[model samples]
Target: MDERVEAVLRDGRAPGFHGLVVMRGGEVVLERYGAGPDHRLGEPLGHVTFGRDTLHDLRSVSKSVVALLYGIALGDGLVPEPGAGLTAQFPEYRDLAEDPGKAHLTIEHALTMTLGLDWNEDAPYTSPANSEIAMELAPDRYRYVLERPVAEEAGKRWRYCGGATALLGGIIARGTGRPVEEYAAEALFGPLGITDFAWTKGGDGVASAAAGLRLRPVDLAAVGQLVLDGGRGIVP
Candidate 1:
């Protein structure tokens, strides 16, 4: 066991870190907890507690969950195929793909992160030149991300496209005819009893698909239990 968690916590550095649990066939075979500093890492200090209902930032976990949502939408006959065009849901992007080559990109390319759009994720938001910074500065973030110039031939190579997930959230919203939160509430969280979470709204009024969600540690464990049951316990 990586009990190093205890030593780290003793040194007062174990804040924000969490433990892991594994269950197979509804049986918990592995359980481990880490001692870390409290989840709240800023002023207005918060207490270090566990096994409580709280929604701490999952960082990139939101991306994984969003992928699940995409799969569910696809299975539910909401989205036809990954080959769907960017302009399919948002026709406004039709003008942006002025290059015939750019028009070849599909939702699958974006999902697989092969869109080849140059976005400096680590760039300082203060820099006006950063694609994300510029997008935030734009009056419409949806349009901003949509119009970003293609950096490489689509589907040529894989790149980590965080924005792609956000765009997918918009696609989901468009498909369901509702906002991401509402769609998630109706489809994902509501059934799972994941009642507590927060999402950052962008200028286009959408949740941050990259890192918008928080989850209860125990609730996450219950998610494993649900999965171990194989498509049962999702609702009712």
Candidate 2:
């Protein structure tokens, strides 16, 4: 371990810092894990001895994975162009299309989180006003997201919104005729040799593409390396 890194680890400055792995030139230069209790929302579940194999929730990091999958699907001609209207994939939600602002929404807007939908994740996740929690509680998650009132013109501004990712997952499933997790297993994880992982579903039974991914730190590092490789080995 580098002397500087060792000093920081010794000092215990980072609270709940469980693991760190640094890779360069396709090689791991530093790898370390610390003792800490696994936590959710500041509440400790239990003491855990961290290791390379321990699976950690990726949380919103899974959004990047979903974006990568969309890129691969696009390369395979399975997904529509970015400019394609959001409603193109779901005619069942055509009622949402009646709103002039939403009628103009496109895939790119969702990917960039510029959907301009009335979403409120600004509050702490525990708050009832959190859009994500509202989406989960909705009987129809997709509809809940799609039917949201337009707060701004699509592509005019960027806002943090997980609902966009949920819709994107639905689009990927519809386009490829497979669930997002299965599609990811075949197209992304298999190629990357990420055998042990989890992609969980939401209350609506669709894969939660916004978050809900669990992966080992090393496997997460593989994803970083793959991105640095510019889709060379993984996506053809």
Pick the lDDT winner.
Answer: 2
Q: Write the per-residue lDDT of candidate 1 for residues 96-178, one digit (tens) a residue.
A: 65557567767887688788777667765457665655665578666676667778788888876667787788787777778
Tens digits of per-residue lDDT for model 2, 60-173? 998999999898999899999999999766788777767676788899999999998899898776665999878877898889998888887889898999999988888889
- Supply the TM-score for candidate 2: 0.92
**Candidate 1: misplaced stretches above 4 Å?**
1-51, 124-130, 222-236
lDDT of 2: 0.84
Q: Which ten residues in a row have the lowest lDDT in candidate 1?
A: 36-45
Question: Of the candidates shown, which would achieve the greatest TM-score relative to the real structure?
Answer: 2
> Whole-model lDDT, candidate 1?
0.66
* Native-to-model Cα distance after best TM-score fit, residue 157 in candidate 1, in Å: 1.7
Provide the TM-score for each candidate, comma-separated: 0.76, 0.92
